[model samples]
Target: MEQLQVKLGEKAQITTVMQEVFATEVGAVYQCNKRNRLVVDFANAQIVLKVDAFLRLKKAVDSIDLRDMAVNTQRCSDYELLTVCGCEKLYVLTLPEIYSFKELLGGAKFALELNSMLHECLHTQVA
Candidate 1:
């Protein structure tokens, strides 16, 4: 658990504990082990997702063809719509926003995989 102190008033303060999985200039992903949830903060919005839902969100984001979407002249192609299984919020993003979002997700995915690998290697008992 990580503790952070925030000042709300002269006599008010608060603290929050979270493990940051990944982050970019535009957003970040945080893991709350105690709650078994991932908190995604992006585009001025925050979403709480379970592990499976986070994976699904990454898959959905990866499937989008940014190049095609950018080159296409269709009006609908100007923006992309994204939704993750078990998540209620719909993400409507423009080309640049999509790029940033993709970057954030990709970084988070890499971090998660690296953590898993490290955990496995550290816990394995070599005979």
Candidate 2:
């Protein structure tokens, strides 16, 4: 995964993240007196999704517990497969290269931080 860049200002902060696997640009533009919005720029369209939508999605993903899940890691050809189960649904991810579990955990933590920041931005705007 590529690194996510966050810029904090006096009134608002911006987060810029790129999905290297796909043609997408996901960002959050936080400002005062307005709802914090999530901007998703695709190859052909620019979409502004409400931050609440992301919050809901984040809640669902955050509910997942790795401790209760079964993990199967294997290498097939040039890619690696990470299968996680034991939740309501099964998840299979194909990673182009091998990555440490710590790295994945760190990514999840970063996501949670991002969600918290977004939530706080919205709360500040509303208050």
Candidate 3:
């Protein structure tokens, strides 16, 4: 079987979108700083996010679509990295991150719901 490898750059784009949406809704100023420096040579890999960047990413993911994650997506296993070779970059939600802030602020619920829909649409590109 071929390895499942996701491009670091694609993942970064998803993270960036999530971060922007979360920041806009929560009034939080979040910025995605490039933690891993990638190169054209896909074989030579040295890409990894620092602790702070990881935390920010986690928060952004959490804030994206908590409701859908709880009711709809499958939870991703606890792995430092997800490699999806032969498959393009995609957003896989883990359950715990899905239903965070069960009781949301005004308009926040809609934001999360929209994020969920957006995520599903993004997944369709892989096929």
Candidate 4:
């Protein structure tokens, strides 16, 4: 396994149709911050967000239904896009990048499961 320890204050270029900008540093797991946050590295950039924010992102990603899109566009030689809009910037992941993302999320499996359960509980309580 590769070393997953990402140091603080690392930066990566994030781009959109408009322009590209550097990512802002956020808290990482290696640090002692009790903010209920999950950190993932993409292209060497750290993406740190709270559990609630991550839950919202999960909702957005679910709404996209990439699997369905993949099935529909299987024959098309174009890359499918999944754009995640964070509070600071937008993260646009291509189909290949999505695979890396899946791996990163797998590292945070416990957090993902907990977030999913908490989300369901909140909805059930609300209803």
lDDT: which candidate is best?
A: 1
Provide the clashing-pair count of each candidate structure. 0, 0, 7, 0
lDDT tens per residue, model 4, 2-115: 233333345743221211111123211221133344554455565556556555655554455456656675555235444455534366666555555554444355554675
Model 3 misplaced stretches (Cα beyond 4 Å): 1-47, 68-90, 94-127
Q: So what's the TM-score on candidate 2?
A: 0.27
Please name the candidate that would achieve the greatest TM-score relative to the true structure. 1
* Candidate 3, lDDT over the whole model: 0.34
| Candidate 3 lDDT over residue span 1-127, tens digit each | 2122324554442322213223222132222234332111112222234334434444554456444434553445321232333223233423442232222221343454586798899999876
Comparing 1 with 3 on TM-score, the higher-scoring candidate is 1
Question: Which ten residues in a row are the worst by lDDT in model 4?
Answer: 15-24
Could you give candidate 1's per-residue lDDT for residues 9-70 as a string of tens digits? 35855455778899899998887766677778888787778888988988888889999998
Q: Once superposed on the true structure, which residue ranges of model 4 sit more than 4 Å away at CA?
A: 1-32, 71-86, 106-127
> Model 2 lDDT vs. the true structure?
0.37
Worst 10 residues of 2 by lDDT: 24-33
Candidate 2 structure quality by residue, lDDT tens digits, 1-127: 3433333334755545433212212223222223354432222223333545434433444444443333534333233223223112222322311222233333434655786799999999999
In model 1, the Cα lDDT at residue 93 comes to 91
Worst 10 residues of 3 by lDDT: 37-46
